[model samples]
Target: MTGERYPTTAEVVTGARELTLRYPDLCHLGVVGRSRAGRPLLMLTVGNGSRNVLVVAGPHANEAAVGGATVLRLAALIAATRQRGEDDGSAWHFLLCIDPDGAVLNEPWLHGPYTLRSHYEHFFRPCAAEQPEWLPHSGEAEAAALPETRALVGVLDWLRPVLQCSLHGIDVGGSFVQLTSEVPGVPERISKSAAELDIPLERGSSDAFQWPSPGPGVYVMPPPDDEVAVGDGAHSTWAHARRYGVTAIVEVPMWACDRAADTSPHPDPEQALRIAGAALRRDLPLVAEVLRAIAPQLGGGDCALLRTVRELVALGPRLTADWDPAVRALDAAPLPPMTNARVTSIEVYAQRVPLRAAAMLRRIADVPLVARLVDEWCAAYERAYSPRWIPVADQVEQQARSVIAVYEEMHV
Candidate 1:
């Protein structure tokens, strides 16, 4: 078994190379690209077969856990498979570190004592344009069009992987996983695996969480509209892979580990790594199973829900005018390029409009279906705005009660 310790990116590379040298027939190393500081973006191939699986990490600088865990796990997997004297000979190729520039910027504070607030302020506050991961350059037309992206794009084009998982972490919130393409039976398997690991199953993006009862793998939410653009350009792995006939594209949240007891600081980094590593080792097989089940129905659904969401956002300014003038002011202001005005409006409504909606729901429309839809939508909004699901639900319910009390007082 690999040592239960946190390995730096350099150490991971050295260790991977050493493992490959020891098991020449089973392992090989390839340079995909270089970071801004000229660190090699390495790709490691385990097993001799042709089934390529690509895992990318550290697309965003602050989300280092994804990349860190991925490299360490890849190294460990290679070593273990070789020692077992079992060359399964599956062609499993991993683009282990896709964003070395972002990873490096985050490495300095890996073992530091900075609070989440300070960490965000120091390392994550940069606008996407300023970020090396998102900023576009001469050859690329998106933010963070670094050399690392080019190498990744090249590999995806060459390999045409069957599965692509991009690992990311949220600073605060319950754990969740996202799949671009929904597969049959996959949701249940993911939920079961996450439950075993003690992580909740979520759906959609983090912005909207009106997930139905059988959630995917964590909370079901929608991605903010602005974040969508980050996935559109050439620098985006999802966009590039889809073009290359790649089937499964998922973003796995780091916090959603079976063993991640809490997002709070762990007294033992080794234990944390072990828990996370074990979770991945166990979950990947489940993920592979889901991929096989969903392969037939690829690209089947009409993304009408997403389109409806866009329409609702476009109508937000008009809706907010009667209740809050600040909405108009914000809409009229010269906002930054990447800011999503709609999301801001929804956030404001989460803080202010629930009471009015609750009263209106109770009074104007007592129809069960409409009321239920309204309640579910409101709950979803609350879940998105607040990190803790229970408290956010409680506060929203209290506001609803207050609205009812006010209506009764006015009547009296």
Candidate 2:
């Protein structure tokens, strides 16, 4: 648990397997699925009873920190549970590495001497299409279907966990966690945990603008407008959980846990695991608390919002002029300067607002008053610009950037 800097993926997996074997009474480990290249999608279950908490890491290969950390944390948790003999009837299960292929793609950098710019250029920046995790399958292609996706889907369906966490991380800046707005009280608990660990809360994910004075450590990302469910995609594990009545949390570890100051070198595998373990230990209790509070409304809500999001993406280029004024206003307002990153963030927001407004209308199915309010908001935007005023391509690009900002705000 406390030696060396970074551990290789093979080393981490081997260690995890050993832990499961060493503590069979407290843990159940197995291959729930396979990656595209046929590597086992390893899973570990700790504790006993029907009430389960699910954690997933390595959804994207580049973000292997989450998987490594989760494995180590599971080992520690199992040890603690055995010593205490606390049969609380609550179990924690994890899909330790959901995308081994993707993770393997990032193995060269896992050991250390992390270079942010180099890593971004060599690995992370390409769109989902270029990434194994995001590629869609076709009937005729030989390498069409990804083993990782199939394996994950099967396990998720079988387990149907009460609460799920999909682990991910960013290259630059502070640590942040992502959760659905539907999960009430999560933001505060997460913020509290981050403060305890001295990790600054990021107001949003990578796409969001950095605040003028980003407070010392990690911060919570801002929430999207109440009506719109803006996020990566409906295809994500988090979105899948929403469909199946589970509360999901996406943990984004920007850097090692112990190295709070931005000065330290990226942790080696050993150090990274230690950092990850500490974070899960510190934050798990808060996750449990949030789940308890929102149990009643877990999977009961209007799903139409997802459809509206898709429509907005399709209509974005056409909605350019309508959103330009708002974007300009946001830029002019007392906020951070519009860096290339920030510009992208603003565009994402501009694209999402209209979609959210539409979704709000559908949400208030029976409440005429609320529906009327949403309609009025939508109409006002509709009247704000002429169809031909802004080029469709430019509008679409701007909206895309705005969506990124909204995500940053939510993560921070």
Candidate 3:
């Protein structure tokens, strides 16, 4: 078991290979697919129960290691307990480190100070559309189906497991879960695990857009958006929910404090949507202004950092240019029944936007203008965020336990 430590793609691969080799009678390793950068994606199966449970980790580069660690621990746990029929006749599949190229890019800070600053300094997450989990936008022109995603789709088709849990981690906010439906007792198991780990539950507005929650910290999974979803059922979980029994997404947070769990009354969903949309619209021009002022001097750049800056400069407008229209459509949609959970959308965005922007700018710190921008932007973002981080060990352990708890309920 990997415990609380995050590992690099190579480390995860090596560990999986070792486990399968050490427990030949209990588990076997298989190559899932090659990543975009040609790294072999591996899946390890441990158990021989009647039912199949598929657990995926590290689909997103930045969030991969924590989930990778969790699933590995879960595999060992399942192996230990299921010898006594503890898993209710269920075999487990673990997909380790899906996007190796992107994950390797962020491996520098895995064992260290574990501070927000250090993480951002070493972090890199692809835009949502480009992410392996949501790629091949069945119908979009922006991103084609990635090799990693295609492999995952094939696994889903071949196994059609009864439960699919995609392990994910958040940069900010508290812990939350996304389920295809309200699985009986699963929410309670998740809430209990969060409490045991001392991680606060995110009872406020979620970033799942307009998706409604059946209970505190448990949201009903929504369809893939126009930009990210390819067909009617493009997302792996969404596409297979009907054929399979259920899918649960466990989102572990990188940082959380009591404020993250606040359930105070706030604006309605519609109003919160508009508020967030307005911020996006407002921030675009400012981001563009910063890009414009620095563009000419950036032309001589000959590094990945410059290329990312160039992409962001071009991709920023393309990504956010339609906020105004999107908000209008959001306003037109029917509102869900009200609840006391706070509308933390703007709060989350206030932190997310600047923090992420600062991270991007930090990558090109050798450039004088970019370095200056990074300092100013990061300071402003910190002031606005005023975040208190949950201990790293607590966060990682909570996620591992959360998965175990959910899996237990599924077999019951």
Candidate 4:
């Protein structure tokens, strides 16, 4: 019932409390830890079975579809099973929004005419360096860690749950599942659920983060030693994976299309990636330079969001340099036949984070150059990608169902 549109932070918290109030014997609500902004970090516990499982969302702010939407949906599903005397003997622990402060910044589009325009217009994600889930792995730095990270760590230590699912979502594309440890039938189960829900499996590589894809829609988490460079560092899903049975990072697309999973060989293999690389090479440097120039104008005021905008914009040249050369090599390699997923990867995935950063910068500062850039890019998205909005209900269903499907597999 909570998934027609994304639930706001208040609505999510209230729902958890209400669930606990209505079924006090079955629901246990407790404060996990306080967030950086002094918000109480809440965790809702359901069932008293032997297996302790943790499902959390809101590690990335703007991914609200899975933030509270999936968590609440998962709760409702499990609760219904209990009412039907279908208990599975697995205690489920849930965190609706692990990063409450960051999530609050994304509430505007949560109650929306969900669209690419509306989403980018209101998007906000913390810089990678500053994300609570990926802080550097240094004992000395632990003291200065963001409270959100500490809160997450606190819960992880306390639960020591054998199974964990840290939920996430993409603005576009289709269902992709990541595992710190594999469950034999999980990938097939995810594909079946996606097909049933009409969400395709997004098998293409993402521009933002690339991991080892071992199956149709499954990504294997990189080893912990390489975690800092390729995956979430110090305190994250990987941390839980080391101490738990299997940690799953389940991602569902906010928008979907059959093209996401299409395997038909593309007419011009590698063209879309090359084109995307070219566009990034041509435009990123200019945005980076302009933002670098005006950065000092924001004197005496600095926080995560401002720092994130500046850092990502400044990183444009490096991003383009790395991307262009890699894609160019694809031109020479005897690569497998291209597919429609390549177009989805290039048009939507490649430009997602940077474009979102551009929109965010304009919101923070109305610089003419930045504003013009964002306007031009938005037009390009409409003309090239045809950004369709996947209904919120579909996203919630896919995310929640995927988690449950895997849990049921573990049970069996």
TM-score per candidate, in order? Answer: 0.53, 0.54, 0.83, 0.89
Q: lDDT winner between 1 and 2, please give it.
A: 2
Report the poorest 10 consecutive residues by lDDT, candidate 2: 385-394
Query: How accurate locally, in lDDT, is each candidate?
Result: 0.43, 0.44, 0.66, 0.72
Best by TM-score: 4
C-alpha RMSD in Å of predicted model 1 compared with the true structure: 21.3
- lDDT per residue as tens, model 1, 1-412: 1333224566657767876887787778898777767878788877765756566655665564445455445545555765697644445565556655555545554544433322322343222342333435347564346576567767777887655555554433333444433334445554454444444333323233232223444322223233432233333455456544333323333223222223233354334333333432333333233333443554543232222223333343344332233333554433222112222323333332222222222332244543453455445434544433222222222222222222222221
The lDDT of model 4 is 0.72
Q: Supply every candidate's count of residue pairs whose N, Cα or C atoms clash at under 3 angstroms.
A: 21, 48, 4, 0
Native-to-model Cα distance after best TM-score fit, residue 108 in candidate 1, in Å = 2.9
**Total backbone collisions, model 2:** 48
lDDT for each residue of candidate 3 in 241-273, tens digit (9 for 90 to 100): 447766777888876645657665544655655
Per-candidate RMSD vs. true structure? 21.3, 20.2, 4.1, 3.1
How well is each residue in 323-403 modelled by candidate 4, as lDDT tens digits? 344443443323334567755665575566567777877777788988787878877766665656777888888888788
lDDT of 2 at 312: 41
Cα deviation of 189 in candidate 3 (Å)?
1.6
